[model samples]
Target: MESEQFRRSWPFTGVVLWMCLALPASAVAQDEGARLSALELLIRSPQLGGSDIPRDLPGPPGGVEVPLRADASTSSGAAMAGAQAVSATTLPDAPVRPSSGDASTPGLSEEMSPGGPEGSSALLSEAPRTGVSDGAPLTLLPESSPSRSFQVLPAVVAVVPGLLFHGLAPAIAGDGQTARRLFAMEGAGLGLIALGGVPIALTGASRRTIAPLYAVTLAGFSVFGISALANLYSVVSPTFDPGVPAATLPPLELEMGYQYVSDTSFDYDHFVSLGAVARLDSLKLEAVARLAPEDGNAQVRFGGAYRLLGAPEQRRGDTDGSSLDAELFGLYHRYPTEGFIVIGGDLGLRGRFAMSRVSPALAGSFAEASIGMSLQGYSYPGPVSDGNLHEQLLYSFGYGVWLGRGGPFKGEAMIFYDHRKDGFAGGLRTFGGGVVGNFGLRGRALLTETWGVAAEVAAGGALVGRLSLIYALGGES
Candidate 1:
């Protein structure tokens, strides 16, 4: 009788919870429309809303991103720091450094991003960027790059181990049951996944390519989180209420969506449910001088979307977009060469949504942004034979190389670490990268440039295939 009652009310409760969660998204969407309008209008008539904007809004920040807020000048430092503290909770981890039009260079990842307000970093040296040319030997200057202020990923990796050993240190020391022991570890893991991407983001700058592996690692982090939460609920039957992020301290962006990832494994010859992504994009506001945005720009945005697919999602179909949440890799760029050799590794952040959606391009490469939630489970498909996947906020971070450059015959070889349990996974966490080869029908001329087809195939993990598609989305006209 209890089970039957739960079955009936379970859905009702879930629906109510969903509706409540969606409120923020709706409100944020409205805000995005308003901002877009205001910006559009401002672009047309600067006098209209410019006067309405708070005079206190920090003027657009300038110069390179600083790692530590202490080094920041005036209140902008503290304001940006405060903003990061608040935004950190609402922001979704994004690996977008590698997604721009001009980011044609090979290997150099824009993963280690800026901290609050383009803060400083311990791993880098402060230096301005005017010389990004290839032959220049790519100096290791932190001040000149965006990685300084945008890298909030350490939380994902550090939290799990730290919390498990620290937060529950007392509980573990006591004579507790196996459940308590595992729960402590699980709790720590989830906590880390939730915060791992923070530091990386806080310190990220706009100079390098943001790799997918970093945020992808969040997937593994989520796995442990979901498991911990699920177990805790099962044992304690805790209330479904969760904490709201600090940014939305007073009012937050509510969002919701459904996304999925389906893959066909050729080697194992089986179709599997990779997972889905459902998330919100938190909006942000930054101020920079008008003289040169690239030189100094402040920005803020909010939004959220469902994960259409995971890992090999791009091969399936493109995903949607949201105005909330700061756009993760907002930097623009161009690749130096057509092809080059890069060496790196791919790490899996357990069940973190990896779905990539390629869009119609304006030129040679796919230029667009990704929006969706970080799925702790496979949101794409229904409960599979593997059982229910836990839900949590998680991201993955890993190191790897972009071999053979961006053009055809582009290959990526990376060593992947599955931080889901941090125990390290082999097959379940795909390591060997895929291949995207473009075979031009004619020469690289009028016909070929204007019209061509490309075939992409990835063999590893849960997906294996040889998919081909024609290219012509605003190409050379």
Candidate 2:
């Protein structure tokens, strides 16, 4: 009877031991699950002001801790209570026997411990220690808040006296970086004006230095104008996007158009023109022909250009960064009434620079310059007419903007000076028949990917206008 009683007591002892081992594992699993669920709820809650959470919250002693705003503390407290209740239900009915002080009390609510649910609730009620712990709530100003009232004043100032004071608007607005750049640009412009103006004045505006001086003076004015515009733009629209989609020129293009000349000397008023272009890697070939049907006059030009510097052909896009090119061209002209023919060949250089990096308002801005020398032979109906070759210089410089990259509408506008004294303008003479230069405006706008229109107006020796339709055969859409 003694051996049987010992055996029965052994089974009861084994059962108690098993309960002690299982309780802690069950409690750990419950705690982990509760923590994960609470975290998920908190993250999905819209009351936390989107996803901008504080990064410096302190971790709890044995688990993760999330700092809660004052409005969220009540709901979080309820969640902690539910987690404690669930942990309690998982405990075994028989009390877990503690071995030394190492064993945790089974079925004792976590909320009742020193670092318990109440302690966490108290911590949550206080603002996060990162920055808002001073008892004041965190508040963000609205986008159109009254504190930004001073912005409009800068815009007004930028428009009035700001034209002369390039950086004043940005300086007043506390943008030192932009202000410095604008002031530097204005200084450079002033320096250029002085450099060009003083010499011209000292020399009494001699004809020999007039052209170069005029160019430098004009460049200074352009710089001033651009800087003034930039100042106004910076204050009025501080956050404008200057990005244009990358675009590339096509391999082939075709164009046809009509031109109207308003020359007092020429009887021919209308002409039809055809043009074609073939582009290869770093090389371009082009041909153009114009005919005056009533006057029986015609002109034809052929040319090829090779890129010497800048990005390669494969890298060219709508925003062609910068490029320098050399070209060789030949032209043939037939005059009806004058009964003369002219043939010429020219060698030239062309360069373009993009200015998008300077300012958003001038995103598509570009400057171009071309210079060349042409050798020509003239023939007339009379035997005394000489066929000797004559040399002529050709040069032009312009500034413009490229518009509508990665869009249906695409175009360019430019104001330029042309030094050629030919065509209807050649017959007229001023100040002892000296050649007069031309000032011109040219623009081309495409309505869609395949078709577009162009117009040009020039005034100087003679006034001229041209209109045309353009089609792209193969290129960027």
Best model number under lDDT:
2
Error of 2 at 410 (Å): 3.3
Candidate 2 regions exceeding 4 Å error are 1-246, 312-320, 382-388, 423-436
Which pairs clash in the backbone of model 2?
A: 247-317, 247-318, 250-475
In model 2, the worst 10-residue window by lDDT is 98-107
Model 1, span 337-439: residue lDDT tens: 2121111112121222211111111011111122222322222234455433432222332222222222222222222322222110113432345222111
Per-residue lDDT of model 2, residues 312-427, tens digit only? 44356643557899999999999978788989998989887665455433455666777777899888765654446687667677766665566657677777766677753343
Q: Any runs in candidate 1 off by more than 4 Å, and if so which?
A: 1-373, 376-389, 392-463
